[model samples]
Target: MSEKEAETPGKRTRPGPRKVTPKYLENAALFYLQRFATSAANLRRVLMRKVERSARFHGTDPAEGAQWVDALIARFVASQLLDDALYAESRAQSLRRRGASGRTIALSLRQKGVEGEIIDTAMAAADEAEEKPELAAAARLARKRRLGPWRAAEGRREARERDLAALARAGFSYDVALAVIDAEGPADLEGEGSL
Candidate 1:
């Protein structure tokens, strides 16, 4: 093999990211959107990372790439292909079902680049969709993790404090955690016509 093509032990060479252009950014954005839901700010960050990589490898002007990103984001928002509110609401609901606390959900949405106002709205919508959302979420978490009342009677006493701590770390309030941990059985929580 030629010296240039020769491989170092335990190392493999791969091509750098493609050069950034308006069309390239648009295509990348569309491809990304098709595969995952994202907020506009998150999408901007993703596109900008590509621009930075291209700037490094191809000497592309980052300022020009950023302008293209701004225009692309604006177009996507106009087309309703990128909706932060919708993304936040859907993500919040999914997380709630998996036992995420309200605070956890809000923090998660923020990390995804959703605005605080939009996060609040999404959280409110999630709460409206369920009665006692926090309680339900805590119960779901207890059941999934086999904590609290879900544990076998023989072990429940010994594991009570640990179970409460788990719920606490999962973002449940003391009252909610205590309620779930002190329940008689799963039926007590789920039989109230809420899951």
Candidate 2:
């Protein structure tokens, strides 16, 4: 029988008389964390997966096997190997840079297990960093989608209203939607009192 297989079941894994080295487990966790930053919750879940597999191999109860994994998490957290706040902040910033709106980014963070107050704060910070795209990008998307070009010649008011409605449906806030849609709209329909 293998050395590990010869161990008695009555002994606790931690500080036990056997050669219990968590070096491999520690290396596995550090390697995973090195390649990518992870939320504390996510790291714990990963450790939990390893614990379950170890339990299956030893015929031990999952809870008994998980003590080591829990210890791993405690070590990692104490060493600052996992930080949920930093993870949430970085993720929100990345999504914002990719053009996600503040509201959308907040929802994404919440789904990632980020707390509501932290998510709200992160999104607020992202908004401060975001420079509204001068409506150019929104206009370009409208042009590509062909949702615009207010037909003022066909009667101004109806065309302006339609353009406004289309931009609203495209996820832009009222101010941004109006600015971009009107930027490409017929001047007569958008600004002048004309038929």
lDDT of each: 0.92, 0.61
Clashing pairs in 2: none
lDDT of 1 by residue, 25-87 (tens): 999999999999999999999999999999999999999999999999999999999999999
- Model 1 TM: 0.92
Please tell me which predicted candidate would have the highest TM-score against the true structure. Answer: 1
In TM-score terms, candidate 2 sits at 0.56
Model 2 misses residue 25 by how many Å? Answer: 3.0
Which candidate number maximizes lDDT? 1
Worst 10 residues of 2 by lDDT: 186-195
Once fitted onto the true fold, the runs of candidate 1 whose alpha carbons sit more than 4 angstroms away are 1-12, 191-193
Q: On a 0 to 100 scale, what is the lDDT of residue 42 in model 2?
A: 72
| TM-score of every candidate | 0.92, 0.56
Estimate, for each residue in 23-125, the C-alpha lDDT of model 2 and write its tens digit: 6567778898889777666776776666666655655566654676678878887887777677888887676555444556667777666788778777666
